[model samples]
Target chain A: MAALVETINLTRYFDIGRGQRVHAVDDVSLTIGEKEIVGLVGESGSGKSTFGKTVVGLHGKTSGSVKFRGETLPQSYRPADFQRLASKMQMIFQDPYSSLNPRMTVGEIIAEGLRLHSTLDSKQVQARVEEWLVRVGLQAGHMSRYSHEFSGGQRQRIGIARALILEPEFVVCDEPISALDVSVQAQVINLLGELKETLGLTLLFIAHDLSMVRYVSDRMAVMYLGSLVEIGKADAVYFDPKHPYTEVLVGSNPEPDPELERRRPSTAIVGEIPSPVNVPQGCRFANRCPKVLEQCRSVTPQLITLKDSERQVACHLYN
Target chain B: MTGVMTSPQTIPALLEVRDLAVEFATYGGTVQAVRGVSFSVEKGKTLAIVGESGCGKSVTVQSLMGLIPMPPGRITAGSARLNGVEVLGCNVINGKDIRGSQIGMIFQDPMTSLNPTMRIGDQIAEPLQEHRGYSHKRAFSEAINLLSLSKIPEAAKRARQYPFEFSGGMLQRAMIAMAIACKPSILIADEPTTALDVTIQAQILDLLQDLQTETGMAIVLITHDLGVVARVADEVAVMYAGKIVEQGSVDDIFYRSAHPYTLGLKLAMPTNDPDKQHKLNPIDGSPPDLFAPPPGCGYCPRCPFSMKICDSRPPENFEVAVQHFSRCWLHHPQARISPAAPSIPRELYVGERA
Candidate 1:
């Protein structure tokens, strides 16, 4: 199957003065197939969000190519090109409260996307907005309410409705349910899953919640210090994670079962994540990895595919 | 065993909360946040209060500590007795003394808990100075010791820096240091790890467990995450609409939950195993408005097993086991309720093992 979206060695670097640069994203290559949900899982400062933003054209790529439907994205900053792509690709931000304009009513928020992407009349827009509101499990009366008046779950529903009303082929859901309550988190996840199937949408679900990402995504990718550390089928990545970083991430999650929790192995990774500005020469996870090799401190490991499997791991052990 | 109660152990708990009710007087109306809630935490154990947002878990704890503001909210009726002393009825001066010295609290957001302009060392030292009357030099050294205790790297240098200089994990460690500064008997941690990433959250939870073991302090952990509750809590209290729907040992709560709400919540959580394509069964309908609370079960509206009595009158908590209790009418004989209409769909209970 042809990929709906593909990034070829995409890199984004921030020049932090004095001939120094921060590589927020370094040589990341990925593909998103039609109607497939790809989860980008990592802790803070892993550059998953930066990668998502770069793909969606929110951030300009320093080097490399982004292709959408066989057409190469413009290298330079072009508003028209971005606007044209914006119609097909949408992004749901992390914080629904901050992402939405407080002054605007829920109706206006949902309609804004339609107005930008569609040439619908006022009545047509209102009907479409209502349709989306119901699709996201909200009532038509809620349209008049402000963002603050609604709960975190409702606000997220509004955000989802706004994003989906455009009927975008692909969406970048950046920690969309992180701020919500646990009970509501499930609702939002289920809603996203259902919507994906019904709308035939491709998703790049970015989040720190490993369990949730594992549950929802078909394929999962782990990021570390602005680079892909591991990528595989969701089951393979979660159950039999090869990379030490991935192992720690999976183990670190406190198991919901008390029995399992008692017997769960200790995570190999310990101590706080190192500063992004002072990234290490070799493995970024070398400082905290339990099985750190001498060569790990001096030589950066390239991501390598093992055997005939789709799983890719970046570590000296794999090398 | 000399001082311990007889078999089936009916000794008074470390903290006993009875008929606890709290209300907030807002311009919109009087919001009854908590209503006739009761539970207890044993010594050297952790009691997790689990609920969704606006379910009044935080409010119940805030009332216990007298942290609720007067104009906006007040504990109307309740007795929160800690070690046989009434905490709610105590004066502010006495409460302040008890707050840091006898009962410590860790709030949800560590960034907001700390002062931006203040040095990390001074913040940790403040509680010690206020409660212990230690001199500035002594307190500073004690602050560094506390930092080291939390296992922060280069504690002395980190203590000299400001809150902004610390990472989320470091700041949380600092918060823990501040919380345990006075060596309180009870530590109320309100979602301490919610804002942190999973790796940092795991580290912090481990630190909290270690601290609990070292100090033998009873912990009242307020959170909505069942996963967290399962990990740290010795006992669990599932709260809804300001009342405890279920309370039991961690094993019972996780494996053999009696309340439908508790069962639903467990089913809703996404399992870590990626191969399991378990469909999440989130409870339908939102939590009730506490300002005009329903007469019966607050969770009845969303509950699949809701009976007619659940919507009419509040169900009395029935003892299922020695300490396990649930407020659902399913176990009560007097309710004489039939199965829900059309019955809860089989798919809703899909991965639920018998």
Candidate 2:
């Protein structure tokens, strides 16, 4: 099957000043198939959000090519090109509180996308806005209210309504449920999963929660310090993680059961994530990887396919 | 085994919070931040209060320490007894005298909680100087010792540095050091590990557990994360809106919970258990508004099993087992249809095991 979206050696760096740069995303090449949810998992400073933003044209790529439907996207997408892509690709921001404009009514916020992307009449736009409001679990009465009037979960639903109102085929959900309460998080996740099936939408689900990614995504990719460490089927990545980083990450998730939590063996990954500005030349996770080798000091391992399998890992131990 | 001493239950509670009710006089109206929240902490045991952002978990703990601001907020009801002495609204002894010296608190963010301009050593030593009447030199030396006890490497060197100079994990460790400097009988850690990464959070939890063991100090853990609560709490109180809908031991709350909301919250998290491949059963609606909270059960609006009477009549805590209790209409026995289970899928059945 032809990939819906593909990136070749994608890299993004921010100039933090004094001629030094922060490597936010580095040499990442990935493919997203049609109607598939690809979960991008990583911790803070892992650059998962930056990678998602770069792909969706929220940030300019420092290097590498991004192809959508086999058409190459510019390194820094032009406003016209980006505006054209806005109808097809959109983003659900992380912080629901700050993402929506407080001044605008919920109806206006959801309709803004429609007004920009389509030539719908004002009455038609109002109807579409109300329809989306109901679709995302909010009532028509909530349309005239301000963003601050609703709770975190309600605000997130508004965000989803705004993004999907344009009928974007591909949406980058950047930590959509992280800020929500546990109960509300499931509602949002289920909504996203249902919308994926109903709308045939493709998603790049970016999150630090490993277990949640396993549940929502068809395939999962693990990134560490601005580089891909592992990628494969969600079950394969979660259950049989090949990379040492992925291994600890999957194990570090605290089990909800009290008895199991007490009995589970320690899976502590020591050492804080290093500053992106001062990234090491070798493996970025080498400092914390339990199975570090002498060769890991100077040599960086590229993602390599395992024998007779689709799993890919970027650890020298596998070699 | 000291036959003179009985079981842990008989041991007088180190800190007892009875029917705490706090109201915030907001411009919109009166916001009932805490409504009849009652729990107790025994010596060396941890009682975790788990709830979402505005669920009164923080307010309950803050009220215990007399930390709630008085102008807009006031404790309208209840009493907190420390070793049988009344603490809440007690005029005999100032609450401030007992706050840091006896009932110490560790807030969520260590950076803002600790004075920014002051050095960390001084910040940790302030309570010591103020409460224990320790002089500058003695308090400074004691602060370094406390730092070392918290497992901060090169404690003496780190002590002289400001709060910003230390890393996040280090700052949390310093906060622990400050909270425990006096060896207070009760320690209230409100989301202490929420701000740290998983690895750092684990380390902080371990440090707190170790400190509890060494000092035999009761810990009042207020947090929203169920996993954290399960790992640390000896007893758990599940809060919603402004009330504890369920309260029991970790096992009772997790395996045999009676409240529908508790079950909903549990099924919502993405568990590591491989058998749970199906979609989570999310509670369909947002939490109740506290400004004009429903007169009945706070959770009646979102509860899947709510009965007709639940709309008008408030549910009280019904004892399910020896100590396990749930505040729900389903436990009323006669209305026994087991309030309709939330909209969980049939394939991903929720009550199969419970």
Candidate 3:
């Protein structure tokens, strides 16, 4: 199957001070198949969000190519091109309350995207808005209400509605349900699952929570300090994570099982994440990795595919 | 049942809260933010208060700490005993003395918790000066030690830097330093890890656990994430509609939860295994409004097994086992307390094979 979206060696760097640059996203390459949900899992400052934004043309890429439907994205993204792409790709932000324009009513918020991309008239837009609102598990009467009037869950539903009303084939769900209550989070996840099937949407679900990502995504990518450390089928990556970072991430998460809780080995990864601006010479996670080799400091590893599996890992251990 | 001894070295409870009820006098009505909530934290152990937003977890702890303001909100009735002293009834002088020295609190956002205008050293020293009346030299040295304890590298140099100079994780460490400056016997952490990413979250949780073991201070961790509660909490308190619906040892609550609300919450959490998608059973409907609380059980409207008796009368908190209790009609003797029926599908309970 042809990829809906692909990034070839995408990189993003920020100049912090004199000659010091923060390589937020460095040489990341991945592809999202049509109607497939790809989860980008990582911790703080892993550059997952930055990478997502770069793909969607929100952030200017420092180097490398982004292709949408086999066409290479322009160096300096044009608004016209961006608008055209916006019709096929949309992003749901981390915080629903802040991402939304607070002043606009829910109706205006959902319809604004449609207005920008679609040729539908006012009546048709209203109908479409109502349709999406209902699709996201909200009432039509809620259209007149402001963002503040709704709960965290309802606000996120509005966010989903706004993103999907454009009828985008791909969506970047950046921690959509993290800020919500537990029950509300389940509702949102379930809703997204249902919507994915109904709309035939491709998703790049960026989240810190490993469990939810594992559940929702078909393929998974583990990132650390702006690089893809591991990528494989969701089940493969979670059950038999090969990368050291993935092992710690999977093990570190609190399991629901009471027996496992008792036997929880002290696999706590100590030490704070090194600053992105002054990232180390070799592997970004080398400083905190428990099984760090001497070669890990001097040589950076390329993401290479393992035998008889789709899994790819960027570590010298694999080599 | 196997004789798994529940007894650990029974240290005196550092903080005890009894029948805590907090209400806000709003134009709409008296908003009962916390209703008859009670729990205790023992020294050297971590007690996690887990619940969704508007579940009264935060409000209950805030009320216990006397952090709630007077005009709108007031503690109608409760006694919060800290270090064998009544904290809620303490005078301004005593409260101030106890706040940083005997009881410390870490809020949700470290960025907001810290003073942007002040140097990190000054912020850490504020509690020491106020509580202990330490000299500048002594306070500064102690502040550096506290920072180091929180695992901030080059504590002496970083002390001179502002809060903005530090990253989110470092800022949180700074917050912890400030919190533990006076060696408080108790620390109330309200969603301290929520703003952080998972890896950073793990680091902070480890730090908290280490600090608890080292200082022998009780920690009251307030959060909505069950994963966290499962990881760190020695005991768990599940709150709903301004009341503690279930309170037990972490094992008791996680494995054999008596409350329908707790069960629902556990079910809702997405498991780490990808094959367990069917296990995620989200509860239907929203939390009830505190301004107009339900006459009976607050969760009765949404509970799948809610009965007629559940609608008219509030169920008394019945003891399920020693030290484990839940306020639900299903657990009541009068109600048809059949052993937890296997109503939920097997796939939802049994996770995918490892």
Clashes of each: 0, 0, 0
Q: Cα deviation of A108 in candidate 2 (Å)?
A: 2.1
DockQ of each: 0.65, 0.65, 0.57
lDDT of 1 by residue, A45-107 (tens): 889999999998889899998998988988865878766877799999999889999999999
Write the residue-wise lDDT of candidate 2 on A57-144 in tens digits: 8889999989999989877878898789999999999999999999999999999988988999999999999999999999998989
Q: Which stretches of candidate 1 lie over 4 Å from their true place?
A: B1-10, B91-95, B273-276, B334-354
lDDT of 1 by residue, B1-354 (tens): 012111123379888888888899999899999988888888899999988888899988877777887868877897888889888867353467678778888899888889999999999999999989999889999999999999898999999999999988889899889989999889999999998888888888888988989989999999877777878889998998888888888888877777888888877877655445468877777889887999988888888777878898887777777678888777775554455443544434333542
TM-score, cand. 1 vs. native = 0.94
Chain B superposition TM-score per model:
0.92, 0.92, 0.92
> Who wins the DockQ comparison?
1
Over 4 Å off, model 2:
B1-11, B90-95, B338-354
Instruction: Report lDDT (Cα) of residue B78, candidate 1.
Output: 74
Selected candidate, larger lDDT, 1 vs 2: 2
What C-alpha lDDT do the candidate models reach, one value each? 0.85, 0.86, 0.85
Per-residue lDDT for B68 in model 3?
76
